[model samples]
Each structure stands twice: as structure tokens, then as C-alpha cells.
Target: MAEIMLLLVFCLLIAAAVIFKEDRRVRDELRTQLTQRDAELADARDDARRQTAEAVRLKRLVVESGRSPAERRQLDEEWQRLVASDEVVSRMREAGLSPERLVTSAADVATVQPLLERGVTGEEIAQAVTASQALADAVSAQGSVSTLSPAELVRLAGLGQAAERSGKGEHDWPPIINLSEAAGYSFAVGSADLTPEFAERLRSKIAEEVVKIMGRYDAGVVEVIGHTDEQAMGKRESNLDRDLIPVLSGKTDIGTLSPADNAGLGMARAVSVARLFRTDPRFSNVTVIPLSGGQMVLPGDAVSDGSSARDARERRRIEIRVRRPEQPTQP
Candidate 1:
């Protein structure tokens, strides 16, 4: 009887151990399955959030595309107003154009679009518009307005790049310095060296303009500015922000020296022109300041680089203007 009781107790102990081990295995598997399900739910939520954001962006684009024509026309006039605002006009005069009126015509937009296309705005555009305009205005103001013949206006407009094509036409960069107005001389593309022909033309053309401005205004200084396209004259991989003065000098061989970028090229050209100005006895009466705009202003006052637009000829030209140092106010 005692032996039977012991065997039964042993069998019961073994059976209990097997049941406990099986329970643990099932519990572990259940916990793993739950963790995997939780991760999948989290991934699904993330995908849904991304889809919602993408849908919203597409919806906004659709709304913008449905704008009515009348709304667009109103926006156009508002755009025009922004361009003609007082701040813009004041900035324009500061840039050198004294506009008789503030309204922008179709031609104005045509002239303005190039600058607009190049991410130029507000005062920069105003300055270009005015500079190009002032170039025309200076020529027009030199003689009586009424006396300006049709042929002369046409010619002046062409050379000054003051022509206002319809805004709808293919956008083209106007000339910076009208070669026709500048005695038929222009710089070679991608070059700052003064050609023999360019040298002869500069001597005569600048002499005439300098005489006119000096006689008509209180100006006593002739500023010969060098402008260039955005193309570099130095290493393509170099930084443009660095100063090129170290490479340029009164005695440096300009032909051999590589200007780092547009600024260097423009300055070198301005210096070249300035050296020529010093040689002439007529320019001795006024101080000559050789300055560089360095692709700042384009033909027709639009802003661009050689890479930005295809109007290389105009962007690559030089300009001559009169500068009047401010006089001291009375105490």
C-alpha cells in the first residue's frame, strides 16, 4: 500500500511540470504576436499621415489653378501698382531715371520682365528701368524734346534699349550701352580686353557725352563703369565673393591676368576705360571714377548673368555716366 502511494505521487509531480512548461511556451508566443501587431499598426498610421499631407498639397494647387480671369486681371493691375508705387518711383529716380509719370505701360512691362524673370525686384528693377530710361532721358533732355525727330527717337530708343515691346512678346534682353549711341563700338563676347576699334570709339563717343553732361548739369566728374556678363574670367570652381584686387594693378598685364569672376572682369574693363579717359586732354577738366557694376544691370536696365539669360552682348557692354559729389549744406 505504501509503494503504490509513492508511485502515484511521483507521476503527479511529473505531469504538473509538463503542464507548466507548455503554458510558458504558449504565453511567450502570444506576447510576441501582440508586439508585431502593435508595430504594424504604428506603420499603418504613419502611412495614413503622409497620404493626408500629400492630399492637402494637391488640393491647394487645384484651387490656385481655378482662379477666374477677372481675378487675374485685378491681380495684374495690382502687380502694376506695386511696380509704380511711390517707394519704387523714388528708388527709380535714385537709380537715375526721372520718370514724368508713374504709370507702367505695356512697354514698361516688356522692359521689366527680364529683371522679373531673373528674381530682381523693387529697387533693383527700378534702378535698371531708370538707368536705361535715364540713358534715354539724358539723350532726350540734351536737346529740345519737341525738336527730337522721329528717326532720332527711333534711333535713340534702339541704342538706349528704351524700346518697349508688348509684354506678350518673347522676352529679350535690351542693350546696356547702345553701341550705335556709343559710336558703333562694343566689347567682344566673353572678353574684357579693349579692342583697337573699341578704343577709337570710346575716345570719341565718351568725349561727346562727357561734354554734354558737363555743359548741361552741375556734374564735374565722369564715371566710366565696367559691366560684365555673369560668366567668370577665372577658375570656374573658385568663389566669386573673394576680392580680385590682389590680381589687378596699375602695372599688371591685364591680358595675362585672369579675373576671378564677373566683378573682376568688370573692374578690369572699367580700369581699362579709365586709363583711356586719363590719356585724353579733354577729360582732364573732370575727375574720372572708374567703377564696376559687374553684371548688376543688364541691357534695358534688366538684371541678369551670362548663365541666367542669353543677352550676352548687352550684359557684356560698358556704360559712361556723370557723377556729382554732394556739396556741403550751409551751416
Candidate 2:
């Protein structure tokens, strides 16, 4: 009986040892799970912090963008004022006037108003009168009375005379003639080639007006300048260097061009317009120079101040200017 009791106690001892081993294994597993859970929580916290920071940064940007610079505000105001009424623009078009001419007239008014309010000196008035008389004499000689005021008449005459006197108008340049998109000189998006209607207008309306202006000035070079708005052009391979000559020679179409940037696009469009002038019989003796103004120049010959970012039709334009050809270098 005692032997039996001793064996039962040994068995209980064995059972206890097995139970302790299983308990230790379970505790280690729980500990491992807890540690993994803690690591996951830490990662989640870091992610939330990053997300919050990004949100704050984006909100700040939004607020800052809403507040435009003072110059930008001023530019916006000027643009609003200079923008012509659609009805008036239509009337001017019917009168065979360029829409940009309206802007010029408005700018002139804006400039003169401030000067008039400050009052003109007697000396200035006298000079203006003499200039006007001189202009009238010239008009009378041609059997035509100018519709311009005596002052305006003289200014025009002076511009012409100044050009004529400056080494046969080689030194002095004439006012730039802006052919804005507002004047129906529009292009397809991302295209440098002129549409059929665009080409027709250039040959018929624009060329005729330009010829008349050139007649007024002793010009030997016609600078065709292309201007673009401040829209960002995405990355693209440029074909200008490889294809410019071919495009000019009619070996390739201008429509196939892909400019990498605004500057190249401007140059390509300028070249396209210049090609037309180069081919025209009227401009055979004159050099047609193509130029790119890019997005750096604003209307009224001001440098862009980063005031505008929207798509402005008025900003995308072609400007024609007349100048005397450069004199050849003496041998």
C-alpha cells in the first residue's frame, strides 16, 4: 500500500512539471504578441503625424495663394479697366480697327488724364502748338486734313520724321503693332501653325495694314514677334533645331513641331508668321525677322512681374515692328 502511494505522488510531480512548461510557453507567446502590437501602434502614430503635417502645409499654401501681391492686384485692376466692352470691340472690328488699337487708345487716355490733371506748362503748350502747325502744313500739302488733334498730328509726324532723319530710319524704330488673340488672331491649343482662316486674315487684313505702316516709315526689316501667356508647358522633346530649316523650306509642316518650352513655341510661331512675310512679293526686298518675346514680356512693354497665372487671350499675341536693316560691316 505504501509503495502504491509513493508512485501516485511521483506521477503528480510529473504532471506539475508539464503544466509549468506549457504555462511558460503561453506567457512567452502573449509577450511576443504584445511587443508586435506596440510596434504597430508606433508606426501608426508616425503615419498620423506625417499626414497632419502635410495637411497643415497644404492649408498654408492655399491661404498664401489667396493673398496676391500688391503689384498683382494693381495689374488685375489695370487689366479690368483696359478690357474693352464686347459691343465696342465689335464696332471697332466693323470699322476695320484692331482690338489692340482700342487698348492703346485707352492707355493713351489713362496717361493723358493724369498729365492734364497736373496741368501743362506754357512752354509745353507752345511746343505742342508749333508741332501741330507743322503737322497741319504737311497734311495741307497732301490735300488732306487729319482727324487727329493738332498735338496728336504732330506726334505722328515727329515719329515719321524722327525715323527719316535717323540715318534713313535705321536708328529709330516705330511703335509695335500688336495683333492679339482678341483681334481674332487665335491659334489652336499647343499649335504653332496658322489655321486656314488665320492665314487668310494675315494675308488680307494684317498684311495690308502692315504694308501701309511700312510705307509711313523707311523700314527694311519686319520683326515678327510672338508672345505667350504664363502657362506652364509640360516636358516635351523639342524639334525646333532639327526642323526649323526644313519647316521654313516647306520640306516639313510647322504643325508637326513640338516645342519643349514657351520660348521655343513663341519662336516657332514667330517663324511661321515670318515665313508668310518672307514669301509675300510686297516684302521681297525687306528682311522678315522672327523673334520670340516668350512669357517674360507683358503688354505695354513691361517685364512680367509674376502677377498673372491665368490663361489670358490678350497676352498671347504677335507683334510687328519695323526697323531699318543693320548696316553691313566695312571690310
Candidate 3:
């Protein structure tokens, strides 16, 4: 009975040992599997991080490269072709989804279409037609391509066209002919009276060319400005030289006359000349405006230098200045 009890206790001890060994083997297997899973998880995280970094770098590269309008158009056409191709469609199906996300966004697509039709390029179009709003916004912010509005573009184009036309020698009107000498008419003498010799010379040369001058300039009006030297009538007094009124009165105080009074005398002289032109039918189209320079612009002296009669000839002079109709009207 004692031997049987000892054998039974040994059998119990063996069973317990076997049970403990099985538990240890199971724990070791579980620990190995957990270690393998942790390694796989770490590898997956590294690969995901690498792929995310690569994507971010590609996005940055796309944003940095500025594309031209021509390039943009080409990109648009190429994208459209790819989207329409069977290869893209098949790949999209294999991926278990439609290819909407891969396709260009509507706004970007719209921006590129017109540029493509206008002969823009692929890389340029790709820059504009990205899914990334930040990229698109960055490109748009550059203000190089899309800065000008449609109206501004049209206006600039028109100006360029006009400049080209001008360079090509297109003109709306004939070239103006500037007369070599002064126009209108003038006569110088000892008095305001018109000399017959002066009238005859004018009737021949000026009156004959009057029609030609009018037609050439398309002049609506003609102006005649007269100028004279500083000379006035001498004052009269009782008793000194009674019969010498002619010489003394001629030597009047020219400096004392006011501008208005001098201008009046000049106007009268111009009126006399105008009357001569008006009498003839050739000057019918000419409208005469009379003005005065008073003593401001003196006539050139016909006498030789150092002559005592310099003042005498200076007082006996007249002037004429011809101008176009478009000349600004002086106040």
C-alpha cells in the first residue's frame, strides 16, 4: 500500500511537470508572434512616411516651376487624351473606383482649355490644373500671366495695331506745307495811305496766289497783325513856328502814346490793307483778323550802319505774319 501511494504521488508530479512545460511552450510561441507583428508594423509606418514625403516633395516641385500659357495648353490636351484613353479607364477599374480624382479639377480644366485653343503648352497647363488648392493659389498669385483683364488686353492690342499701322506709313491726312516766307500783305511808307505801286504789286502776285493758298491750307480765316515804331503827333502851341507845323507835328512824342491808342492806329492800317484785298474777288474766302504789336517788335532798318537816318527808317515800317486756321486763338 505504501509503494502504491508513492507511485501515485510520482505520477501526479510528472503530470504537473508536463502541464508546466506545455504552458511555457505556448507563451514562447505567443511572444514570438507579437515580436514579428511589431516588426511588420514598424516597416509599414516607415514605408508610409517615405511615400508621404515623396508626395510632398513632388507637390513643392510643381508649385515652384512657373509654366507658360503655351505649355499649359499642351498639358490640358494631354490630360484630356489620357482621361479618354482605355488604359486609364482599365486601371481605374482595377483600382475599384472611378478616375474622377485623378482627372483635372473643373476650375483648372476650364482655365486651361481656352489657353490650349490659343496654342499654350502641356507643362504650363499642368501647373494651372492641379488638385492642390495651395499649388493653384500659388500659381495664380504670381500675377504674371493672368494679370491683365480682357478689356485691358483688347486696348493694348489696339494700341499695338495702331503703332504698327503708323510704322507702315498709313496716314489720314495730307502733309502740311509750311510757307518759306511770311504770308498776308504789308507795305511801309511815310503815311497810312496805300501807295499805287504797292497795290499793283499785291494785285499781281498775292491776289493771283490767294486761291491756291486757301485751298492748300483749308484755312477758314486769315489774320493780319500790324506793328509800328514809337512815334506820335507833336503837340500844338501858340506862337513859335507857325508854318513849321508839318515838320514839328511829325516829330511828335511817340513814347507818350498808350498801347490801346497805338493798337487802334495799327488796326486802322490793317483795315486799309484788308479793304484792298476785299475789293478783289480772289480774296473772297479770306476772313481777316487785325491785331497790333504796338512798339514791341521794331522793323529792321534799311539804312547802312552808323547812319544818322536810322531812326527815320525805323519809324517807316510794316510787318505781316501768316498763320493756319488751326492755330490757337490768342486771348
Candidate 4:
């Protein structure tokens, strides 16, 4: 009986040892899970705070005038400043969007967040923004956007479709026009120089577009954006996504400037276009903001689909958009 008792005690000790080992492993796993959860919670709090602040700013902006010319100009600048924030731009880049191509406002940034969260592409977000703005603009003359009737909404969509198709006096209605389609002259491969024929092309196609946009939208500023394909420039290897700050304070001559990659080349091209418009009497006093899209946008303002390889011709293009002010003049 004593021997039996000793064996039982020994068994108990082994069982205890097994339980202790299992407990230690389980405790370690729980600790790891706790750490992960804590980090997640912290991230959630940060995002919530940022979103709250953004909501407040948007409310204030909305309360401000969007119809008076001076008030509208101030609002445009405010919108530009908000969209130009690093966090917003970073979000755009993560979604394979070129921030340069986006005609952003405070509302656009807010609308983009939920779309990004749902894994929607930036190109889709841009389309949504465009459609939303069209409806909003139509309602401005009648009343608040919230009071838009169903028929008005349908009309806005119809107009959007019409704009997408053949627009009246549409020079570059799609915004993204292939150079081959828009320009008459050819540059000896990889050159941004606008020859006499190219100049005429601008005068006919792009200039006309600017005039129509100015007349129709009463826009204060016209942004000229340039894009190129994934093709390599010259014989050197280079990155295409680098930025070129617009030469706002001085002259931008296409003949004198030599850029390295597709992005730089695109900037030079856009600057060339801007310089052309600057001297034109039609665009006199009108602001032309040039931006480089490089090879970021595929045909039809779609974001690149992660393929470094494509029909190079389709991506070589230029796009334009107008910024409307509250009480905009001809410019």
C-alpha cells in the first residue's frame, strides 16, 4: 500500500509538470496576442482623432461661401492646401495614384478615405468625385445639393455621359488626349520641343479647349498636366516618378530644358504648352498651372495596373482641368 502510494505521488508530480509547461506556453501566447491588440487599438485611436479633426475643418469650409468670387478663391486655396497635405498625398501614392493628376478639394480627400478602406482604386475615386461635383455644381444655381431632385440627379448623369462622349466644341473633352491625336508635328523621339507645326496644334486643339472651359465653367485657373509611357529616356536607366516643381516665378522654355526621365520629360512638355498659352491673347491674365503626371495614368485617366510593360503609345498624353471659383471671371 505504501509502494502504491509512492507511485501515485510520482504520477501526480509528472501530471503537475505537464500542466505547468502547458500553462507557460498558453501564457506566452496570450501575452503576444495582448501586445498585438494594444498596438491595433493605438492605431485605431490615432485614425479616429485625425478623422474627427478633418470633419471639423470640412464643416467650417462648407459654411464658408463657395459662390462669391473672392470667397471662392480663398476656398480654392484652402482646398489646395488641404489636398497638398503629406498624408493625403501618401494615401494617393499607396493607391497607385499620381497626386499631380488629382484636382483635389477637402471633400475629395474625405470621400477618398472610405473608398481606400474598401480597397477601391484611386481612378474609380476620381470618377466618383467628378460625377459628384457635376451634380453639386448643377444644384448650386437652384439650391443646396441636399435638395437636388431625382430628375436633376438623372440630368447630371446624362450630362456627364454627354461630356464623356462628344462634347460641344470638345477639343480635349476626355482631358487625357494622346499627343499623336492632339498634336500635328512630331519631335525626333524623346524631345519636348514644340516645332512650328506643334505650335499650330496647340493653337488649334488645346487653346480652343481652354477657351471653351473658361467660358463655360468660369474657371479661374487651368491646370495643364503631362504624361508619358513606361519607355526609357535616352540610354540611361532612371526613375519616372520623381517630381518637378512648376517654375511659377520664371519662364519655362521647352527648347532650353532637358529632363532625365519620363516624369521630367512630361513636365518639360507641359511647361512648353503653358508657355505657349501664356503668350496667347486668349489666355492673357489667365493662370495656367502646369503639372507632370509622368507615366502614372493609363489611357482614360485610369491608374497604372502595376505592369511596367505596356503599349507605350497609349500612355504618352496630356490632360487638363479647370478650377472654378465662386465668382470667376474670364480667366
TM-score of each candidate structure, all chains considered together:
0.38, 0.48, 0.31, 0.41
In angstroms, how far off is 222's CA in candidate 2?
0.4
Reference-based lDDT, each prediction: 0.66, 0.83, 0.55, 0.71
Q: Compose the digit string of candidate 2's lDDT tens values, residues 195-307.
A: 78889988988888888768766677889999999998988999899998788666888888888888888888998898888778898888888899999899999999977
The deviation in Å at residue 161 for candidate 1 is 31
**If both were scored by lDDT, which would come out higher, candidate 1 or candidate 4?**
4
Estimate the TM-score for candidate 3. Answer: 0.31
Off by over 4 Å in 1: 1-184, 188-190, 232-253, 305-311, 328-331
Deviation from native of the Cα of residue 60 in model 3, angstroms: 38
lDDT score of residue 151 within candidate 2: 79
**What residue pairs clash in candidate 2, if any at all?**
none
- Model 2 regions more than 4 Å off: 1-172
- What is the C-alpha lDDT profile of model 3 across 216-267, one tens digit per residue? 4454455554555555534333221232222213342222222234444455
Error of 3 at 167 (Å): 18
lDDT of 1: 0.66
> Per-residue lDDT for 65 in model 4?
40
Can you write out model 1's per-residue Cα lDDT over 1-331, one digit (the tens) per residue? 9999999999999999999999999999999999999999999999999999999878866865788978767767986898779787789899887666434465876777897889998798678878878767776767665477768777856744532443211233222234421444565544556788888877897577666656544467767677766654545533213423432334444454355677766776777777777768887777877677887777666765445634465566667776566588999
TM-score quality measure for candidate 4: 0.41
**Model 2: how far residue 23 lies from native, Å:** 99
lDDT computed for candidate 2: 0.83
Q: Candidate 1 at 328: error in angstroms?
A: 5.5
Candidate 4 C-alpha lDDT tens digits along 154-181:
8976876775675533344324334642
